[model samples]
Target: MPAVKVRKEEAERAKRLLKRLGLYDGRRRPKREGEWVLLPAVGGDAIGTLGYEVLPLELPLRPERQLYKNLESILAERLSEDELKHLRRYDVIGDVAVIQIPPELEHRVDDIVWGLRRVHPFLRVIARKGFHEGKFRIRDYSIIWGEERLNTVHRENGVEIAVDLSKAFFNPRMKGERYRLAQLVKDGERVLIPFAGVLPYALVIARYRRVKITAVELNRDAYELGLENVRRNERKLRGEIEFIHGDAFKVLPELPGHDRVISPTPRGVDALALTLPKAERWLHYYDFVHEDEIAAFRRRITEECRRLGRECEVRVKKVSDFKPHVFKVCADVKLG
Candidate 1:
């Protein structure tokens, strides 16, 4: 086997270049020496041109099961390359694995289920999901395999959140976003969260910062689950959470201003006018917008700040892709 010897710091960059040039060997694992890394690669003219010393080193082959990281790879033998293009990314929530099977892959449900099970041996349920519907934003789901339940205690960012997909809305994809918000929060700051679903943002923030967070949710089921999540993570939390069960429109008016406000606004609901005024210092507002309308969206927020007589700096960050040319954005508004 041929391996390229490069410094440890340059190993990753070199490996990427090798992979991009179609010279990197995937079956073998890289070896680390004292100050150098031996990257596994196949023989090619470009390998020598990569400016690394090539030597005959016997690299260990990767374990058969550790070769592929995604479900598509495991199902490559079963699904055609054309059919595989329609496969969507799946999410694993606690013991349940949720996937969306397109119309093209309908006939291969059993194979898909088998692939999921093969990839995740500990999954208790496999569910086929539909679009979010109604006011609660709960997705339509049907159990396709294993246990028949959507209720699970999902653990993220050092907090345990009890979620019922049938009742309350919970998006595991927002785990990174929740962690990002948690990192931005400071201790002793008074934080407010409206449209707080299952207290995911609240619980994650409270887990890290020693601050007081008032979270309001309109969904009774989500509020109840949020209460349970607070209790479940009570001992682990470093901060305090006051969960309110009511419409934010009615509840926020009765409450005082806070140091910071986070509005994980529901899709199609514009709460900027409702939540922005309640923030004394900063507001993290989330919404969906078209790619071309991003500048317009920022201008709208800036105008809203001006109308409220607050000097603010608004920066819009694209959080995730909602659809083609559409993105889920977060406007981090800093009030002066």
Candidate 2:
């Protein structure tokens, strides 16, 4: 049928089934351009569907030569089993597979890597590791990495955030974020970043908004590195970002409420899924939606916020296609 008709049907179906159905990774996109499908449950507990151009592309589970098949499988199974939900897609080009995942799945980070190792020595579950390293890196933040590593080449406000896998955890494309954050915050806001993986989000916010950030991280090593990065680049970026060396879940209770809170841990969303240290304010959008389906996605979140009596807005900060159909979003959630 036509794309317009299919979208109308998909929208209607999604509206009625919100309780049973959830959005796909917003990744796994372009299933079959302009076609909407109501799919069966992948494992159990989660109902996935594609609409007006998105469909699932399932490839043969090729473990050999599939670089991260073990890791992907382990993560896919674990996330689906634990949350009974997660967005996953595997691209099988010959014997190799590249699986793109949301940032919210970073906590079980170690398990992801270990699982990959268990699968086969050749299959590598990768991590961007660190954005920066060396004399600038504090003792606790120093990471031990193999001679060779993967890196995410990102640029923000002119300073390129190139990952040095031997050291950092994330190297994000912050263009969308820099703008999205600007839309949500104001001057003098007390922004809190719990589990501040790399401090990019917090710093980005302060630089854009004349705000104060109290960044917290439980990982001693990560905390120190975050602290150093903030200081090292302080001159470059405007505003102050204080790194708190402790768990945000525990830390939040002791501290007073703030003007705003930022949870930069890539694997952040759905408060219930996170058991460690949570900073409460996440479990909302971190993806910046621009045009296209922005209105639809934003409307969904807005409606949910209203149902719970919470006041919020949809701020689209970035828009980039991760893969062919998978897109990454980083939007800010505010409570008034």
Candidate 3:
């Protein structure tokens, strides 16, 4: 297909107008040559509407480059050396870029937003204002640039997940964790996810393994999104995924036994102890703890199983960092 070639400086404005007219093709990246950007257009009509010259060139589809490389260069003149050093990396969830602005560089957030948008023309950048809180475990975010909406469809491991940042919890950082859990699941095995936010873990596992999964969520909004996500990914799924919208503690006990269980809730390990089915199963439990406290965390899971008269072997591994001292750890426990 032909694309509209416009000056690099005017590409953002042209993209906005093209998107508004429903002529933007997201599947192809804009081809750049010298000072001009070649945007994928539905037809030559977009050239007149966007006021750009037509380029009858076929650009090879390529994966997007990292956003930070361009952002760092763009903000070089606007940010001080000390402030630039404090910039943390951001996450791209579909077309939304969720960033955390450090206190030192907070005043230059507008410049940062502009830099992000300039680098990734299609992305809507937002600044994360608060930490993940409450039972729903969702963070507060404010629009820094681009669109005002919080809802977006994020694709991960060949599955599509529809989530609203204001209503539910969806972590793009957990892509590796979801993939790791899916790889561990065996064929024909039954799996359970007690903290299945928007069915990311369940959907990823279903796409890769032929297993039956029962996902439970406490938050009503997240539960509703999970159902929608499951329906959206139905054509690509390889197994059955059932969603239960209620507290894991209450909903888990009534459910049947499963070969594997995943508890990724941020509410702590108490929920795991309360809802674990009284049968032999593999438990993938997540928690936040310091490196030195990993042993104690493992002992806590062991004690929980001991109290229930179920012999178990527990191992803990660092999944990611929660802060400078704290870490997001996973305790893999096998109960018999």
Candidate 4:
């Protein structure tokens, strides 16, 4: 096995950097020798790219630890060590625990749910069947324990959002990104969030800034929930947020222009030209790209702006990784 050796003091920072670069291998524990920490790498090529010393060593395979406490304790007797490694990670939305059960462990779902409930008594467990599909970007989930409902109120950065997991798409991992975006909003500016699922972006921004926000959603259920969320946090908000229930492309052209536009949908950047109120507007566009394709992705955006006859100054930021070698990225475009 190949590993990167770093000073013990720099180990934690190096770990985060490697993970962000999609080069960290979590299956093996790091070895410590004197002042150096040996971190496992996914491949040999990462050493040159990361500027680290690569050390080849013989190490034994260890059982990957489970995030949920009782899952390992309960399944230890019933399943082999290899079977336990399949349980990677799960997401928690309010009182609900959303997990993806591997196809090989389909028959043991009942036991898995039981163990999860034992760890978090108040949590309602749901199993995600597959990747988010269709135009709506919603995933299929089956209730495995506790409540049968999918509706829950999630609190993020002093904002409360009512979301139906089956009807709308909301990623709790984006809490930091939402807060950062809200902080960038100037007072008394107009903002727009297209594909505003359950109004998470709108609510968070409105709670912090005095800007007026227009949120557009196509799904009827998500639109209704967005309305409820607006009322739920009306007293705490410092700004006005209007919930519009219609296709973003159809509704954007009809609404007034905004100083800043947030196209939160990864696939919605092309529609931004239609929503621009005038030249010199700030555009925050989200998209997914391969680790090695960021430069090409920005080039595409630059070409799109040229095709639309809008001059753009663009900057790219990596928000998070969706899977191995694939990242969720944001392009901050200043169009004039």
lDDT of each: 0.90, 0.48, 0.81, 0.79
How high is each candidate's TM-score? 0.81, 0.44, 0.77, 0.77
* Per-residue C-alpha lDDT of model 2 across residues 110-160, encoded as one tens digit per residue: 555455445545432233222233422311222222323333333465443
Give residue 133's error in model 4 in angstroms: 3.0
Q: Pick out the ten consecutive residues of candidate 1 with the lowest summed lDDT.
A: 61-70
Tell me the tens digit of each residue's lDDT in model 3 across 1-336: 778888999998987788668676654678788999988867656456555787776555434324565677788878888878887777788888888887888788788887777777888646555677777888888877777888899988999999899899988878888999999889998898888888899999999998998888888999999999888988899999989888877778788778888888665546766555523579898888887888888888888898888889987877877888798888888887
Candidate 4 structure quality by residue, lDDT tens digits, 211-290 = 88888899888889889999999999999998888888788878776899988774424554554443248888888879
Ranking by lDDT: 1, 3, 4, 2
* RMSD of candidates 1 onward, in order: 6.4, 12.9, 15.2, 5.9
| Residue pairs with clashing backbones, model 1 | none
lDDT pick, better of 1 and 2 = 1
* Highest-lDDT candidate: 1
**Residue 43: error of model 3 in Å?**
53
Off by over 4 Å in 3: 1-70
What's model 2's TM-score?
Answer: 0.44
lDDT of 1 by residue, 1-336 (tens): 689999999998998889768788976899999999999999757777867899987688764324233577889989999998888878888898888999999999999999999888989999999999987899999999988799998988888989999999999878889999999999999999999989999999999999999999989999999999999999999999999999998999899999999999999998999999999989999999998999999999999999999999998877887999899999999999
CA lDDT of 68 in candidate 3? 66
User: Which candidate wins on TM-score?
Assistant: 1
Worst 10 residues of 2 by lDDT: 136-145
